[model samples]
Target: MKKHTFMLALTIVLSVVLGACSSNNSNNGAAIETNLTAKEMVDQMLSKVEQPSLMELDAATVEQLYHLNPELLEDYSIRMPMMNVKTNEIAVLKVKDVKDMTTVEDAIKARATDVQKQFETYLPDQYENAKNYKLIKKGNYFLFVIADPADQDKLVADFDTYFTEK
Candidate 1:
């Protein structure tokens, strides 16, 4: 009877240990699978857009390009003047990829001030609410930046700087 009881207690302890180990392994697997880099997310978003056309325009001309429709401008989170004129619509630039700097929290951390200044200089009018812009890091490879509708031109230009292939 003593040997049988010892065996039963050992079996219970072993089962508990096995269960805990399996749970930990599963959690680790999940973390690995969900670990996405920033660049990957940006690439994914860009891939979904119809081919983007590059165009340069002064700040004032942006409203005219989009037909001066405030409603249209308000419809999207980030509106670029590079539009599908046939449909009178702006292509949505989603967060498709994010690459975090090894040491920085923001994707454009080091370049943030420079980037902001560049936008302000090139597109002053749009920069009125530049502080409100949203920079979302979807993964390690993609950094999704949301531009205000009024800042479409500046945003488009900024976006081109990152998304355009070398």
Candidate 2:
């Protein structure tokens, strides 16, 4: 009776150990990385939301508004409200080098601050939208969005799917 009881206990322990090892191995899935162009990346993120009618800006205008050096980025897509009353904007950028990520992120943050200040006094409702904007960084990509709060989480989740391990 004692020997049978000990065997059952040992079998249970071994099963638990094997289960943990298999689970750990399963956790090591390959990360979802991609070499998508700027336009494609922006399109993927925007697809997750009910896109508003924002006008795309030219590279020169984007550089002027965000105070970023175009040479530092591999590619970028920027859109904004044509009129000042609405505070809707989006920018998805890919840095040429990882070392320049800080500069690019800083420029995006500065742009966000500018957006906030612009709408804070002009339109309270839009100001709230600006305040709830998302600034997301994933590997060499960066995204800044001032959109409807309802679409914020969906946008973030969709962006993350590009980087999350499968």
lDDT of each: 0.36, 0.79
The TM-score that candidate 1 achieves is 0.31
For candidate 1, what is the lDDT? 0.36
Which pairs of residues collide in candidate 2?
Answer: none
lDDT of 1 by residue, 1-166 (tens): 9999999999999999998865643223332223222233333444444424433333344334322322322122223335422111123222222221232223233333433554565556435434344443212222324344444344344434443211
Using lDDT as the measure, which candidate wins? 2
Query: Candidate 1: where is the Cα deviation over 4 Å?
Result: 1-40, 49-102, 125-130, 138-142, 149-166
- How large an RMSD does model 2 have? 10.0
Please report, as a residue range, the 10-residue window in candidate 2 with the lowest summed lDDT: 24-33
lDDT, residue 41, model 2: 67
lDDT value, residue 24 of candidate 1: 45
Off by over 4 Å in 2: 1-32, 164-166
TM per candidate: 0.31, 0.74
